[model samples]
Target chain A: MELDGNSSRGKTIASGVIPFVFVIILMLYIFGPGSDLLDLGIPLPEITIEKIDFVDSEIQATVRNTGPISVEVVMADVNDRIQPAAVEPDKSLERFETALVRIPFEWNAGEPYTIGITIDDGTRFEKEIDAAAPALDFSLDLVVFFAIIGTYVGVIPIMIGLLWLPFIKKISRKKYHFFLALTAGLLLFLAIDSIEEAIDVSDENLAGSFNGTLLVVTIVILSFLVLYYAGEKLVKQANSSKITKHVAIALMISIGIGLHNFGEGLAIGASVGLGSIAFSTFLIVGFALHNTTEGIAIAAPMSRGKLMIGKLVAMGLIAGTPAIFGAWLGGFSYSPFSTVIFLSIGAGAIFQVILVLVKWIKEQDTVLSSGAVVSGFATGISIMYLTSILV
Target chain B: MMILVLSVIVGLSVIAILPVMSEAQLKQKTFVTHSGSVIQTTGEIIDPLYTVSSVEFDPEEFLRNFEYGRISVSESGQTIRDYTIIAEDDKIQEISPGVFFNIWSFNGTVPGPTIRATEGDLVRINFINNGSKEHTMHFHGIHPAEMDGVFESVGSGGGQFVYEFEAGPVGVHPYHCHVMPLEEHIVHGLYGVFIVDPKEERPPADEMVMVLNGFDTDFDTENNFYAANTIPFYYQHHPIQINTDELIRIYVVNMVEFDPINNFHLHGNLYKYYPTGTDLIPSFYTDMITLSQTERGIMEFEYKFPGKYLFHAHKVEFSEKGWVGMFLVNDNHEKNNQEIENGT
Candidate 1:
């Protein structure tokens, strides 16, 4: 009830002003000139050149900020002449952070060269190489290294899974449909994993301005639509032959699994390039274990077709060769944006393969809600989850 | 019921205002100036309010102070002034908070000491190069070719040279290190203002020197931060205190490199512009003027009201990157001076 109108209005005004004034005073005390009293004396900048290597025609010098303050590499010089250089990851190195500074200059072997780096503060630091020799590029040893990792992680695991094909031939129609459902579940997991990996790469390694997440989403959608339309057209044209339809589905599954394996290889190669992780025997074995399930997904759809040995090897090659190329690209010139784009495509392809398998399963006498199909799907996802823990 | 309803509305409004206020607090931590321009805090941890101590170079002290050197009268009734300037490249100065820059300086400071002399005076500069690199004092006004700092390069490691010339052209000019790769010397802070006053002095008020400059911290041939008198947003937090209705003359020099042009704008007032200060008569009574690299002029204006005013780069990018400042026009100069002297 309204007792005194004027006093109520005055009280309302006072209540409103009280919180507002209190907030203003609190903010001013925290952020205003009063905070200037917290001045720690100025920090001095110190930079050290950690290591220098001559790779091809370029000289890559690893620089570290040893000071309390951050340092930015502003210029690179060769024998006092300013030469354009590229700073990888970033030019600004925070305290204790290291960056790779690559300067392209053609120098003769066994010649003394001075590589100078000018920091943000106008100070030039120089590192002298007494004798310049070309360091290791994409050598035979590195190729062997990538091949061995790819064989363990990509090829051998898929070959081992293909070994199940002989045993799968004796299964009845109902049990075969269950395997198809299991393949779909495995591919669904791979699709989700690829998308997750793409998102992580975009967020961590790429610059924010590149719109990495949006790029991944768009590429995934585009790749999915294109592959779905093509797969449907192929299936419709081969409607007369059940064997052709089965073979076509098996090929699509192999290609989709191939793209996912490529993304895995990229992770392996990039980790080595960034020097954040080592290529230990345990890591290779873990990756090999994680990818063995991918092989079964490819083999499940091919059970109905009369599979020739050559056709099986061709499918295996199509799914396994991309990991090799991914390893080479990621090891040599690993850019996060490219990884995001490729992984997004892999996710889209895998999603489309899952849709095709579902359609094929529906074409059979098996119901989509059958208990066998449901259990098979669960087991498929469970296998991938268990193996991924090793990775 | 009305009081309760009103109180409920007030409570809701406070909830709405809290977020925006806290956002402003976050922006303050990011070094956004009062004029709403973001100073370059990306990849930096600079303290926006940090000013160099008195032992180091003070932009406020460098503003109005002038070096007249040792003065005497010649036998022909002419003025004689002798100045000694030591050029050293080994000095490290904290241009911005947490940002230490290698400054090639004259007498240990960037935009060096303002060398002032009257017109027709025989000005002798005893130059010494104490840097590790070649440096020479090159003045912008009339002088003999032999006395020019170019071609006669002063060697590093304690090189000496004498530049003797009669000071002419009543205006403000820049003197810098005229070494090869000239930009390297200029951008690293090897430059200063040289003021040639007329024999018959004009009515003087409060005069100061402002070097509009920028630093390319990323070595990308583009400036990462812009500033007035070396430190960005300095005058904004600590506004240049001045008396109301007083004539304030500012000698502005643009020493920004890698930038095609830079401009200045004053808020709340207009000034009589003297292009290069070459003429006694005013050129334009305007609030804004564009400057090319090394282009300078004299600005004279009087604030009629007692309040705060902004002076900053008209180019929004430059101001956003740190070239903004403020002027506090007060009626009581003595009390304000006392407060400043007490370091409040």
Candidate 2:
């Protein structure tokens, strides 16, 4: 460990905080599977429309309500021609419940019909009825819907980013080179993941023209240039202190991650709106676990620099808050185009961070350890790859 | 030079994807038919103009606990039974959560309270209009046009009008605002049931009153919202409990305007329909019953099984729009204890 006297307090505090965090995560992983504690009711109930289906000329909506508020369902139409609807749990809905409210109506198959229902608590719900034309539910119930979506998308990235501060405070000088390679490896995998997602989103455009391929190539190169210039600007902006330079780079990296996370948030939110609950849960767990490595990437730049608790918090918010905002927007009003644009920005920014890492290794007087660097990169890649597979 | 080339390519790609992508998305959102066929639409497409539905009655359970501001008192030395109903306005009550309806109520609610008494009771209705307009309450039972609340016999806003009449035949009928240009007056939430029980004691049973009405929220001739009670979807959420094998007497009155007639259909149960309270014998044993505007009746049915019985208009349009409700028939208490007795 090589911490100067000036920053020993930060190192000491971070050391204490991270171990406590690890112990809690470890305890949950070990005991949670067998515990009944998670079954306890959520005090505040929230509900969202997951999917709307029209089967056999009847309209039905699948709603997910988390927490403990009771809800009732009824359908009202313009002509008042709704067939009687069957509401499950015909009484009060318990918290942490999902219900499929079947609103059957006798209508012309192609005729446009709309069902509006107002709940007793003064909240109103209006849904357009299109047979098999699934639209995301727009109602008062969706406000809490977006909040939950934000939680699923943001928690993982923010938690993982914040986790690195304590452990990376004072890596031994001997192991610093190894950790740098490891950080590069983690970031490289992120850049790849981001670009792959961006490409996947743009796949819809592949049939029309060569635009998709062009978009991929252009963003990857553009992000590298942007980040390269950003690094140079950080150097020029430095106040002759190593700490200042490191902090600037770290902040820039956080900004890059924030952009990428926002794109990820959009994907998760849209998935929920599309009523793919199983897929949404899978993405949440996979992304959160994968995000566990981002901490190393952000911390690597500041390995030998002064780090304040407040500064680390600022980094976390800069990196993580965008995910929340992104998920909320995604769940509420996400379009496919927004997905491609933001993810492109992310892919570009991360590519920039990887270049900064290479520059760091070359800045040294002696040649970097190639063997340690190669193995560290492999280890880092395998860790992230394995996390993705396992999750 | 390479960066410049890349920037130009990115810019061109963005422009290419924006229009094509957005158009596809709009098409995707609008293509809602079950056939899953994409139908192209444009910005110039206008939605079909719709009319406001008739008087929208809130859910039945919404007014279940409410009395039509019952101010009627049986006084000692008064041969004329005095009934006081305030023709009040501007009381914004929540029929559903956060959904407020402006009701021009007699007393404090739409379909002002049901005034019950024996036949031949002198029904002296004191109509006070605390409203901003003229108001009147006309008895559906036999009454002269002067006491009918029509013509010049109207209570001005912030004034009072006293109507004295002898209750005629024993029957279930609706008393409503009979002010000329009748549709607007009655639909303004000024109507109620006046049940005059037969002099010979009728068979005792659990009873409820259902007033079928619709609302023209936009004041257009079309009735957009409809309900059995004043609040829509009330009985669906908070179901009316009925014990199995219990006779349920229902006094249903159709005060709905815009539509000529409305039907009351009960799912999983059938009832004896009486077009008028005058008949001791029911008109028929049917699952569905229909009543015309201002036509009131007394109906009875007994649920034989334990389950949720849906009651709504047979006309699918009227029932689904806002006139839907449920009666949850519970198992008899004594029946549940039989299993304990058997120790099975």
Candidate 3:
């Protein structure tokens, strides 16, 4: 990578001196007069309140030491009153270590309270709770609330997208392959989106010791192989006609979309649990708009088949109900590991469905690169991108 | 060329900025060495050697000291010792460099004052709980049921109780808070070494107390730092100064909670190990000894030569996490005497 003799010489000198500089620093630190440097008294002891939970007659706050030096919580006060507070384990928190400071105060529900924590250096950190309410727990009311969210974001929107089935069925035979290609495009977008989301979640929340990226990659490959094997076995067993194969493809597409919607449900539910997002009409509308197009992707595959009313309802349920379960899991116990697992599996399933759809499209009499098929693919991706903005 | 000139400039600048950068980084490193075995923390760290200097509590002073209390002859001709222990929870101590822990201590010190007495002496303890929470000192030696420090919980805010008992079961024992959720009280530094010396005193030399302890700084049910006498690496920084070929007796008490067991290993020497100091005769001769929570023993050893020797927890994790120390052995008695004669 050397450009010229001067540049290469410069590079060599730079690399050599870096180690030389490091050794000198090390020697100075160990044997030199270290007291002056140690007594430099650099700024330290940064702390922050990570979370606050109001238990029965108690306000437990998770506080983290974000500074270079360790800090101790010397005292705690609530509403200008010195409260009997016990910092779990001990009051001193090493750098980045979190301590739960529990204060025993008889606080009224719906009342406002301010908590102040004073460290050993006399520096105090104050956090105000707008309203004192019991921390979120599994309850009947919470279940209904999450179900309503699932219905709006997952079930109802998907069912509305399924209304495209009648119009899709009435189309000419020449346009049948175009709709199938569009379905493939939709599944492809979903696969990439879910995998991208999984990677982000893994990076942010998974433990450093665990190879989270590798875990996602492995899970995706395993799920893809498993789906492909299962599909191949079933098709060979049935010795299925074109109609039966098309029906299987449609079912697979529904299941794939269902998994993607489940991950979507998880995000919505976890946001509520973390209190990062509040329940709002606008958010629900945004989610509903984002997911409405999934139904069309699911319906496009079934257009060639003579689907019964019962089967149509069953497909919709298969493409929707998992979201309800996902919301329940996420709202109650939202773990990033589980979120990563589900998203990776959904991405894998979508990828396998896309593979099946592409093979089916190639079997058609028309060229795979025809204008209709190419435009259908482009249009499908464009629709997903446009709707994704709402989310 | 431009590249050569730029490279030289950069190198010179790096060298020029070296001292400032190293000073900033040295404070953040837990310990610095040539091989880069440094724990890079977020910010500046206080010097471990000087950390206790800022605080009133000194681990070296705590070592080898015994609380004999108010000695009195009772009407029954028995020796009576009256000791008043004020339990407080608000005291903050630097357990390590840059790490401060709110220690629930007796008389404002972790491991309290090493309460020592001859066997069969009448030890009367005036217990006062001045903390915000309830606390009761439970001694591990033989005592009456009423004086057990349990059953009758001492309330907070100037609560008082008198524990009168005959010191028996000659051994080194741990005395700690006996409140319900006892681990919570003990882990927060509510424990101390209780020594009931045998009436027939053993051969004395240089005696010191080494209370093996740990602090779970993050409340994560696991210990983040471990130490002897509450301060991690204190003995290592200021190695315990001892004369060569002199008998050294250590009353080692293990008060680490969460972990099942802890151990002590000495470098370059084996000690006469007394199991709990209960028996006069030495039980085993070994370089290492393991003790569970609250289990303590007496160790007697003498350094044959003059040099620095290391003593630490045999459990590698414990030692690596700060339960290590050193003994600075001196063979300079003749030199010191010569200097004294010369008056230099």
TM-score of 1: 0.50
Residue-by-residue lDDT tens digits, candidate 1, B19-111: 999876654423332234343322322234332222256788888889998999999998889999999998877776445667789998888
Please report, in order, the local distance difference test score of every candidate based on alpha carbons.
Answer: 0.80, 0.66, 0.80
Question: For each candidate, what TM-score against the reference?
Answer: 0.50, 0.43, 0.50
DockQ of each: 0.04, 0.08, 0.02
Best candidate according to DockQ = 2
Models sorted by lDDT, best on top? 1, 3, 2
Pairs that collide in candidate 1 are A74-B218, A74-B219
lDDT of 2 by residue, B1-344 (tens): 99999999999999999999988776432222223333233311111111112224344443433232233444653235567888876777654333355667877877788877667666777778888777778887787778877764455666778887777688888888877667777876889888877768688777888888876654557665677777655676667888887778888889888888898888887889888788888888998877888887888988888998888887877765568788899988785577578887
TM-score of chain A of 1: 0.68
Q: Total backbone clashes of model 3?
A: 2
When only the first chain is scored, the TM-scores of the models are 0.68, 0.62, 0.70
- Please give, as one word, the docking class of candidate 1: incorrect
Find the 10 residues in a row with the least total lDDT in model 3 chain B: B44-53
Question: Residue-wise lDDT of candidate 3 within B112-168, one digit each (tens)?
Answer: 999999999999999999999999989998998998898888899999999999998
